[model samples]
Target: MKTKLICALTGVGLLLFTGCTNLAEKVLDEASVSGLTDKQAADGNIAPVYARLPDIFQHTTYFALQEISTDEAILPYRGGTDWGDNGIYLALHQHTSTSTDPNIRNTWLLLLQGISRSITAINTLPTINDPASKVYIAEARGMRAYYNMVMLDLFGIAFLKDDPQATSDILRGEAAANYIKAEMLAVEPDLLTTVGPGRLSKGALWGLLARLHLNYAVYRDRYADTFTHKPEDMDKVVEYCDKLINSGQYQLSKDYFPIFNSDNHSNPELIFAVDQRAELNGHNRLAYFSLSGDQFPIPAYVGANGTDGPAITPDFYQSWVSAYAGKDPTVDPRFYKQNLSIYSNPGDSCVAESAFNINRGILRGQQYGLIRVNGAFVKCPDGKYKVGKLFNTTRNKPTLPVNFTEKIDFTVAGSDYSTGYRVEKYEFSKKSVSGRNLGDADIVIVRLADIYLMRAEAKLRKSNDAAAALADVNTVRASRTVTTPPPALTSMNLDLLFRERGFEFYWEMLRRTDMIRFGKYEGTWTEKTNTDKQKRIFPIPQTAIDGASNLPGYLVQNPGY
Candidate 1:
């Protein structure tokens, strides 16, 4: 028998977990597992914890907080109407976000729910007598640590709790970092190496360890002008990265796009990711969010269209242009991948017999997608789709060509619908023929390329062998096996490594942390000008603070909020 968790959602859309500690206890309605075996019960108890990842990492929540806060991406109000969201995104990009901001509040709630779920699993899984129960318990602990790591990174505090009914011991800074590290270390041995990237595995644990150690200094002193990367932490980063590299369980993806393709669950490069198969309520927002409103990837269902959301900053795009010198950024395999050739010629139209595909990577100038004819997709004679140059379809800008400009001028009146260069790195899922909700792509949390780069950063910071670090970066650069791969760097430094990270991992929601680590988070880009160090971590949601107000110092807001 499989145990089922039926959670009651409150009026405010928060999960009212029943019999749970540290919050309002409405209690979760759980199905009894009286006749279930220990292994079955253990598996069932941990499922909901894993299920919380999709919502926590959604585009409008954590992804918005991470990417919109950085220079890599921006979400301006389109035509003073769409995505206005009462200037929540504008505040996020401008680094003036508050505790009441929806994104912050939603992220905090989801992350805490994930932690709570993990704690619930940890509490229940131990009672089972089977040996698998121990492993499940270890997984629960590891997951709790991962959630806390995100919590600490975002709000500068990690809620540590063993019992569901007890108050959480809020650890900040070094204490939080140490607790996360210790949890992963303690559970590392029990984690299975052969498990898939979606679960808590030895490889995932190692990757998490490397990430924790690499960013350990940032956690130690988040607002410091320059982080003091301790030699020991650097050693740990290198060690874990090396372990991952030598393990041979993962490899660098030769084709960069497949790493984020809808059917990427078995991709070896993924050490850990959110398993977002089409069957689940996964979202294709990452692909759809940054596209032009006129650009519709799916043809079968005319409803499946882009939201014309965020786009890459010109400063970020210029970084790629500068890195390549005279050569166009598109020449680099990682920069762009052209999948559709319908509009290759000026006055040409091609029949997309199977799937109406679009180009991937940083899109600039004119865009192309399915054209609409009286509220329906224009189709060829044979019932195939005909592609054409895209025009603005939303915000009453139908005649405007969907030409993405480099510079965005957002003002009190409005911003252009197609201002910033859009990024379409993740492929539009074939499964999402009808709408944007059903995305199958596993949201990549950790991959081998990141590991290589982490190792390189660790080695460089340690000042042991700059040559080895350069080699590692070159190794990653060489992974792009295009007609002419990105030229290997002649030399490597922190600046170059930082740029390389942007080239490899842009629009993947890692930019904010990267910018902070590189000490460029305070630098101005486009509309963002604020440089206050306290803005490093987002303010604790006012609701969270207020809810715990009775406890006095329980949920303190981050400084400089």
Candidate 2:
């Protein structure tokens, strides 16, 4: 008798099970088997797949990959020292880990499992006659394609199976790209035509295609050690981007914060976002990572409020301040919120006052004060380096001191000094904060602002003069803060455009791709310097290499592995 593995899909009555005697084989089979008319079959397959999304969404995997790939620095912690292990795999080239690190391997397996199950559902859903069901199935396919793209980007390979019941075979190089493109195109027609903003639409599918094709030069020849965008590929990028931008269904958000707000799932600026429900799968740790250390004002942190930490690096902060110099610092809220001190002036009645007083010689033990103001070093009244100000609003009169040991409770609303520039992207409801839940900010995968930038880059690559491209870029810039536009396209070059992109999309998860596209991926940094070979792809996970001994030469590890 065959053993039956039962699975359940809660909230959406779907159960799925597979008949296999071997538990490992059965779990793998159940993970990819989904053709249930009732809850039983659906739950068997769908639940396991859904279970992997939260794991993929974990900070160690998705968040870490996104941050390390970009210019952002990883927070120092154990098990993160070896660039080869995690940092270098992201910073340098494609990497495979043999270490018994569960975080790394679990991330890899979970992402692949997610793709496997999602594809299985997409391939098996023809039996379900409902159009709405088909649309959701298409969404699963699109998401699977997305996961494949990340795998292809990071690992330089993907698991492709033609038959749902067949053991997956890893495809590398151009073969992987071809498979992904075919899958995305197959599901394009079935996706929802007119979903609200931030939801997946046909346009986003094309955008994802554009993204994949834009990197074709790298994927087509991973071990070549040198890459340049082919003209034909650039044409395809232009073609797809034009279709999405001219689709007339999406537009840039008037304000930047709304794009990342908890209520921004339907914002018009978003093309696609990973839905993060604080109640269901709350792991938006970007807020916590980006907050300043002293910003913890909640009663739990001994401060009047929650812990506010994660300041912009001095170098990165200077880049933004330089870009919008001479403009009202308060105008573009994105700049202020992302770069400025969180605290307001002492006399100002703003609910969250500045924690550090620049005038007095008070420095909070936790907060790092402004080391430089308008390009000059800040000094205290006592002629010493004024690190930052600590504010005590709980007292009848707000007190400013270099260092204070007074303990204050943050139970009351005004009692907590919500001072300091914490990331304003994630909305902090009283419930979300007090409950210690992940912020429900939509993880925008693609946005209209990105389209503008892509078009600008493509046009710049084609026509040396990017006046039109600059106009498109400036349109997004204008929305951030009220400012007179810069001189009309006097100079538009790759460096300027690249820097603009860095400033605009700092932690939005496209930094590594953007850097590679502009030929800066292998350049040296303060902490990392990668070789040209490292620029092409990451090494296959050592486990994958160890598992597939039969497939000799078929699965060669990336160079330097």
Candidate 3:
């Protein structure tokens, strides 16, 4: 049975959801909202609000603006041809991007879409007439605040409107931070604290609140050298982290890969994540974006090729090597995960035969995968797959037997594309040949480990207690599968904490924010030699301003742009 509830919202607005095809003829009228239970319509309204998040995380979009612009990753033109969007990427890496950057514009539009839909849901949900309706309304408001928080983080100003036709108001700095914190805190009592890692549970709310307070000083004064950290704010951060820890619903996982694997929806570490599935709205960019075109993790599956994008900076790669130089690096579980065939596919069985079956955390040595001869996989008479060297069409040469160097000098020709080590943190989906297609891994947003890390940083910053901070970090190191950990730190400081965060969350899209707060964003690194404090917050896209024809001067571009 399908229920169709169509609320004719006035003015320019967004449809609440792309799914829920059931909302049809029967529930199309305004009066019909009374006929269905609140839970039923709640699912219908809340979907589109959550839908906006996938855009920010999608590869080649807003996520590109965050990670590629930092010292952690780069999307240099491959072989002097590929990913050459007329210097758009180069501009981003150098902090020379203007308001006309497409990514900046798209992010603004996508976030506003969420804000609009949430308002619509809040306005329409009450008429459902079930007590459960109020709960959904609260959820809608929580989601709205979360979306605004993201906007404020990226653009320095969040657009606010109670109705679709209302003039958009701006909130920035501390005001925006307080708005996000208060909204989440007010409604969290009714949020599903016990029900989900996918849905906005109380744990998720607390994790976000903890992040807001922990970074409160940064948001309050982004360009300041000695950031003013309020004890009250840091105390609130500790309080929220404790809330999640005491809830007893989440824990740090022993094996790091499982927490980020294809089936991570059930992972205990995931406080909140996008419920991405292959059958639903799932994109595999996370799994294979950094992979070279020739390295096929799944031979039987074919659709789109790897983008070969956003390789880790040589600087970031060396950070690990230098940090654990004296100790055995293998003991740090987060640094590496070897590829082992647990699938029945004949292609996977061939993975055992590849020249380099080693799927190290940072892919630096000779790359290995399936070889195609005459449109058929080359296999030995014994029926095992035959692994061979890689050849790139761009360079038109078989170099070093396909060895990927750990160093990337972006200024050099052809050297930029292939030099840097590829990121291999997220595992390729190794399901059956029949089931394989796009990636199905949930994109983790807030995890339990990050909560602990936040608490430790809050404590370190608040009271300068290095011993207590070290203990919190050690707890994460102890839980990983890699048993060979670096010796317990004799002391802890801000510099050490920042380095640890880079190692822990590489390629997870927190680098820009981390760099800003650490006062390292303006520093020279590889291609990013220019330093501009205004570049910390991205410009409000000029396209957004021009599109708001109805309200003149409604969207002022960010300071520099």
Q: All candidates' lDDT scores?
A: 0.82, 0.54, 0.72
TM-score-superior candidate, 1 or 3: 1
Candidate 2's TM-score: 0.72
Q: Once model 3 is optimally superposed onto the true structure by TM-score, how far is the C-alpha of residue 230 displaced, in angstroms?
A: 0.6
lDDT of 3 by residue, 1-561 (tens): 345454323233332211122323322355655565667677677676676666567776666877889988877777676778877887888899988787776666667667877888888887765666677788788888888887888888765667755665677888888878888889888887765776777788889889888888888887687688899999999999998888889988878777877788888889988777653654446766787766666655433234567687777877888888876455566776656432223354444333323364777666666665545667767777665556553245545345667666555553445667787666566553422234577788899889888888999988998888899888887776445544556678889999989878887878898898878999887788888798999887665555554456655677878
lDDT winner, 2 or 3: 3
Task: Indicate which candidate wins on TM-score.
Answer: 1
As for candidate 3, its clashing pairs are 3-23, 4-23, 4-24, 331-484
lDDT by residue for model 2 over 356-427, one digit each (tens)? 221111122334343333334445554544444444322222343213211211113211233212333454
lDDT of the structure predicted as candidate 1: 0.82
What's the CA error at residue 224 for candidate 1, in Å?
A: 1.4
Stretches of candidate 1 off by over 4 Å are 1-31, 35-37, 129-131, 346-348, 412-414
Candidate 1, backbone clash total: 4
Error of 1 at 16 (Å): 10
- Between prediction 1 and prediction 3, the one with superior lDDT is 1
Point to the candidate with the largest lDDT: 1
Candidate 3 overall Cα lDDT vs. reference?
A: 0.72
**Model 2: which ten-residue window has the lowest total lDDT?**
10-19
